[model samples]
Target: MRAALKWVLWDVKDTLLKVRFSVGEQYCREAERIGLNLKPVEVNSAFRQTYKSYSSRYPNYGIAQGLNGHSWWTGVVQDTFSLCGVQDPALLQTVSHNLYHNFCNAQNWEVFDDSKKVLEACSSLGLKQGVVSNFDKRLEAILKSCDLLSHFSFLMTSEAAGVAKPSSLIFEQALHNCEVSATQVAHVGDHYINDYLASRSIGIHGFLLDRDNKYNQSGIVPKEHCLNSLEELPSRLQEQMD
Candidate 1:
């Protein structure tokens, strides 16, 4: 018989809450406010390119090797502006600060329509819930502002754990925090590697939330482990328990 899942750990951004604005749009708006002229699309393209390049070099490389969240994101913002032909150091700092603060506001984000129902169902089942995300410390404040703080018993960030996902350390920390063994926990998130494979590596059941059906073509996850929506979660777990 399979062990019953007692804890449902979650990844916050892109899983429960979606940012209302794209990084490029937010950056461009902040830049315009600071007297810089740039189109949203242009800023978006540059931001994507810069972010992709950074990720390619260091996957989920946040708050490690003496780099804190502010410094890490400041570098990203600087690189983004540099790619967009805005190379002024002081201006980059100002734009990055504005962009960072904008993200902390709950108005800048929206919870997925299916998220609350799933959380409520899981809660009614008496399952413990918490957030295990690769975000920074600001995630706690953001979750609180988004009205999601009450649903979670704990929030673990990359900054707090000193390691990001795809590393077993963070998942191990989550297991420790929940006071459960690996087999007694299940994690759900949007990313294939960071969410699914990472949790699975440490024996935690992992489910990928592929709401758009985009991952069907990639074959990164077995169809059984892929969920198209959070609404399916409670029933899926119940079926497993049965």
Candidate 2:
């Protein structure tokens, strides 16, 4: 029989908390506040392109290349604005810095509607929780700002773990921190490969939060493990323990 679940590891981004505004909108807002003019649509598109390029070039904040989280994200921000026609070096620096620090504020993030209720339900069930996210160092402040910090016993970021999801090392580290066998834990995340498969590979139960039904027809995730909302989770855990 599967071991009783003692813990529920969480993925922060897109799982519990999401940015309150589009990157383009937030970036344009910050720039315009400082007297610069830019189109939200253009800035948003540029950011997506730049972010994808940066992720491909520097996976996990490019730690292997001696780049830390701040430097890596700053590069992405600067390049994104540059692509959107912000040519003045001083202006780029100013906006990039503002945008970077702005993300750490509570105004930039929102907790999912169901997150607190599910967390409370799990807590009532006597289970501990921790964060295992592919996020940078700003995660704690962001979580705190969203008032979600008290729910977790620990926070593990890619910056701290020196590894990111889809890599077993971070999950291994979470397992160690929990001091429990893999079978006694479960992970919930929105990403298919990163949160679900990665944890399952090491024996932790995996639950995919398919809020958009993106994977419903993918034929990849098992039907039992796919969840449409956080509300379904406490019951799932109860079923597992039975």
Candidate 3:
């Protein structure tokens, strides 16, 4: 029999909140203003490539020893611009700063339609809720601004934990803070590795939210474990309990 779930841990980006603006489009627009012409497609490709390389090398480097959110994001932005062939140190700094700060504003993001409903449903079920994300300190303010802060009892960030998801350390910290064992917790998020598999690896139930139906073609997850929306979560959890 499955243990009764006492808490639900969540990932922020692409899970509960979706950024309203495109990062690549914003970057290209900023570049054009600075006399640097960049195509959104090319800039996005370069940014993804740079991000993948950094994530591979550092593997949760945001909270890795001695790195804070600003420094980590600055490095990512700088590398993104550099890869896009912007070699001027002054220009790189300017664009990176612009990109980083732009994300700090809540207006740039929107909560998913299903997010609030699911949170309400879970709350009605008497489940404690909290955030476990690879984000930085600014997350608290973002959540507050987005009206989501009240739903969560605690907000754990990469900056606070000094480690990102897919590492058991952050998940362990959440369990410790909630005073619950892994079996009593379940995590919901969009990422297959960082959110679902990572939590499941440590005995926490993991639900993969595939809102776009993109993972339907990927056979890595069982149909029962995959959800098309957060609206399905409460019922799914109830099924497990029964």
Model 2, span 146-205: residue lDDT tens:
888999999999999999999999999999999999999999999999999999999999
Off by over 4 Å in 3: 33-35, 62-65, 214-219, 240-242
* Candidate 1, backbone clash total: 0
TM-score for all models, in order of appearance: 0.90, 0.96, 0.86
Q: Over the stretch 157-205, how does candidate 3's per-residue lDDT look in tens digits? A: 9778888788999999999999988988989999999998999999999
Model 1, position 110, has a per-residue lDDT of 90
The superposed Cα distance between candidate 1 and the true structure at residue 237, in angstroms, equals 1.8
lDDT of 1 by residue, 74-127 (tens): 778889899889988899999888777778888899999998889989999889
Among all windows of ten consecutive residues in candidate 1, which has the lowest summed lDDT?
A: 57-66
Clash counts for all predictions: 0, 0, 0
Which segments of candidate 2 are over 4 A away from where they belong?
A: none
What's model 2's TM-score?
Answer: 0.96
Strongest candidate by lDDT: 2
Q: Each candidate's lDDT (Cα)?
A: 0.86, 0.92, 0.86
**What clash pairs does model 2 have?**
none
After superposition, which runs of candidate 1 have C-alpha atoms over 4 Å from their true positions?
56-62, 215-220
Residue pairs of candidate 3 with colliding backbone atoms: none
